[model samples]
Target: MSLPYTTWKIGEVEHKLRLTTRQAVAVEEKLGVNLLKVFMPRQDEDFPLPPLKVMLVVIHGALQKFEHGVTLDDVYDMHDDYVDAGGDQTSLLTDVIIPLFENSGFMPRQKETTDDQATLTTVK
Candidate 1:
């Protein structure tokens, strides 16, 4: 018999998205990867948490990386500026932001510019 497909869920719906184990692992190692960990946020979780918050955090990380190549780890090692960027900025970067960047086919590119317009090209 063919092996049944395994599935993953985001929010309520079962997503049809596909990722190889290597792809998933690359994304998982980054900040905010859920790995289906109990510590990770669930859509139906209690107050002061949700996936949207994580997405915002990661997007802000994108902005952070845009503004300055602030490795999310650096944010943890040092404080002051990143700490004050906002609660939204901090929690999400380590939870959801980096994962999205990887899972969304953005894993292998760096944002760049030419003619004063932004662009991304695959690194390999």
Candidate 2:
């Protein structure tokens, strides 16, 4: 099976972002909050987008797995490069960040049912 990862391009470099269990724990420690909780807001509060630092931390965490010795500063620079290349923060969040978590299995995936399975009749 293919490994779970999200591809992010900054300038000429393509980064594979994957959050393994260890990386996820490290990210949570750095953020001082549960990784999942970062995306979840209090029931009484409106859902707020994560701060830039949180995004960078997550990106760095995912990147460090494959790109050894990579630093958070490198991630910041990558973000700048991405923006300079016409990638906006909104698109980055929607396209990269969200997909990263989804691909990492932190978020529930949509179950795909084939036509044969979809046509199954229930027995009483």
Candidate 3:
């Protein structure tokens, strides 16, 4: 499997997106938590979910790296439009980005099914 690409449309243009290592670091630093931990929580514990604002910022930061022509202001404007349209931003993170992280191996160990019992598979 590979990193999933999300389609981010700005006006009439659609950009295929994935977060880079640098972008991940920026998101982590800004949020003060491990992004993977939050997205891929262990079965034994729960990680704090990022607030809506932080989620938006992290995604915007990631987009800035992948989509060169997109500006921070543009991202915020798009976000506002999304909200105005009654779209939930949290879904944008969970439904879209989290799956991409899981496939891209950005997530840590997650539960796996074994014939005898459940096991953990570490994603590299």
Highest TM-score: give the candidate number. Answer: 2
Q: How many residue pairs clash in each candidate?
A: 4, 0, 0
Instruction: Identify the candidate with maximal lDDT.
Output: 2
lDDT of 1 by residue, 1-124 (tens): 2112222223343212234455445435564465444235457765423344333333334334223454545434333333454434335444344444445444543443664353334342
Tens digit of per-residue lDDT, candidate 2, span 1-124: 3446789988788899999889999998888998877777677779557788898899999997788688999889899999999997777878888889888888875566767776773321
Predictions in order: lDDT: 0.40, 0.84, 0.64
TM-score pick, better of 1 and 2: 2
Quick one: ranking by lDDT, best first? 2, 3, 1
Error (Å) of candidate 1 at residue 118 is: 28
Over 4 Å off in model 1, which ranges? 1-44, 47-73, 78-80, 87-124
lDDT of 1 at 113: 60
* Residue pairs with clashing backbones, model 1: 32-94, 32-95, 32-96, 58-97
Measured against the true structure, the TM-scores of the candidates, in listed sequence, are 0.25, 0.80, 0.60
Model 2 CA deviation exceeding 4 Å by range:
1-3, 42-47, 111-124
RMSD of each: 16.0, 3.6, 7.5
